[model samples]
Target: MGPSRLHLAQGALAALALGAAVLLQGQAPAASASSDNLTADRVENLRLGGDGVAQRRHMWTIFADMVSDEEPDFVHWQGESGVFGAEAAKRPSGIQGFQRPKSIGGDPHLIGAPIIAYNLFNPAAFAHIRAQGLYRKATLDRLQLTGGTGSVPPFPAAAIVIKTAWWPVAPEGLTAMPVWDPELNPPDPTGNPYLGWARVVAVDPTNISQGKTAAVQFVGRSFPGARRVQLEAFHHVAVDAAMAKQLAGDPESNRTAIIALGRPIAVNDQLALVGINVMTHEQQDWVWGAFWWHDRPEVGPFAADRPSTLPGPWRNYLMQAAFDAKTPRASDAGAHICFNPWLEARFPDGGQGGGTVSNCLSCHQRASYPAAPFLPVTRGAPNLREDPALAPDRLRTSFLWSLTLHAQRD
Candidate 1:
């Protein structure tokens, strides 16, 4: 079947199951009603407050600033010599830590070819998890179970999770290329060496609560919006260009160059704001921010080419959405969001299969602390579709992935 038809079919099944569950529990039908009745303005206001537009603009500015700062507090290096200072020796000690050991080889198959990731959790978010009385080790262990409750509390509004990749930036005067090792199974690094991308996931309880349907509400204490944002920097390219022009540049000197180019350039500027992703409510498809060049007819000279090595469906999806306007109404001053047709088409109705078919929210909804060590779900795991069998019976982690890390001994 075509993508739209498939999505409709999957949504129908989910809606039926959701409706039946609500009816069986004797809940009011109004609880399951769609947010469609609410005007766009009302929905935006409810989620973002009276100054919603200003708040969104402020957020975008903050994110832009964060991405540009060369010495940002949130940036951490993975492995033994990370920015955590002496604390690096202590694994899983701080709120901001690396996910993999420094020595781990990069995943050759992944795009953006990241060698390692430095994950940063805002102080409030870190403290909130600690307040739950669950330590990192216990929390990580608990998350492995297929069922049962955990001591972790839901992430509060404005909680931010930032992950920065360690990829080599492409030097100036060269086409962005992938660095690969033939011996490696994955072949390429985790992120693009020439240009690294940082991804952010922020918790917005106001937006989330306003958009939740009965099915989402029935789960208890879960919020509606979990905004995701991504930023890209051409550290290598910018630095390379600066060095060639000036004749006296090194990695340390190039730091300033990278920061200078962090903002949007007229055309072919090294650094750029990629786009943002937002999900204000459970009933709606996650809003995606297409890159600026997406609206242009030509694939602008600065646009990165899809790596031929990528899987077919993923490549095709990227190509289609490159210049398409999926949600024209979601202007920056309004909802400040857009849809990613490629993502929707690939994932369909969010009923997961494997590979790129994974839905962001659906997959994350399964993020709760397991009671014991069970098989961790792979990237392409089938969607649980909010199946009760797959959901926890009590308190959940509410989609926070960092809570699953094991604490290290001093």
Candidate 2:
């Protein structure tokens, strides 16, 4: 698991490149899967076995448990409250209310739809941070060793963290349920797969105009009455107009798109959950999984072990997982690639010019107090044993970037 050179077959590399290309085009590839869907009893299995498919299925079980409505929505659990505004802090009842995503960062904005995001911590994660007083930058800096590689203790086995991306239906005031237009997305201009394959969604012009709703409209191909079906089912939260305006403020271009979509905004406007990144420290290296909304949820390796118990909108998401830096022994040994198209597709490697393949466990492994750059220093497969992004001088953050990036000064 430590830094070691990995030699992958040319064919496997090509497959990953092809997969990435298909995603950029905004079209999901056809499925070729085995019968690995999970059941209620299987949800308890957390071991990342040697088999890649089984490991991914194990991750799918974790995803199902996280999104289960039997418990409070992840948004209501607890946020990385040490950040600015403290708007995401938990309520007296222990339910952390929703907060507007501060920035789009490197995430991609979908056609006709601009993206927004927020992060939350499970009880175990939040408690560990609070108990250790790790929310303060000073605490992290002080923990850095005067000598030796300053690796901090890892979080407990039960700790979990989530970063969710959303589609903000705009106009600040428009709460009308919107429809999904299959044709509205721009066609893949570059027919060659390398440039990207499917058509990206089209931007809705009427929704972007400042304060004007002369004719609220969706610009792409029409999907009659399919309003909330494809993406409508995911859990959503209300965002007031004031906050919506603030989130849409920076990128003048996104300002409009953020306000136009259907759902909620401004007390009434609701944003749909488009994709999410889930990290569970169930194992030492930590098991990583990402889920993105897909019109066709029954295809691909990510869709392999989806359980029927995953209610409504949760079933619409397609997931991929990584239990190690290199592929599991059961699969062709290659750089494991798992990322949410909605979350990491736009950027090269999770961010900047990093690696050819994106690995969530690998990326988060670099989370350190002196804070390593979001982009991994190593190219291709990152060494899980000895991370280049994490130096001995810095304190590791147990793979939680929210702790490293969002923790504020006291």
Residues 20-75, candidate 1: write the lDDT tens digits: 43233233232222423432334344333433333333223233333333443343
State the lDDT of candidate 2 residue by residue for 1-410, as single tens digits.
01111212333442233333323322323212221122212322433344766666566656765666554347545643333334334332111244433431232333323456567777777767777767766677777744244655556666777877766544243323332212342222211111131322322213433332223234443333332232245565555555555444435224434444532234444566667888876666667888877655776666775766677778878877777765653233455666666555443422323222456765677777765557532324555556655555667877777667666665
- TM-scores, all models, native as reference: 0.37, 0.66
Highest-TM-score candidate = 2
Each prediction's total of clashing residue pairs, residues at least 3 apart in sequence or on different chains, is 25, 22
- Model 1 residue 144 CA deviation in Å: 10
Per lDDT, the best of the predicted structures is: 2
Whole-model lDDT, candidate 1? Answer: 0.29
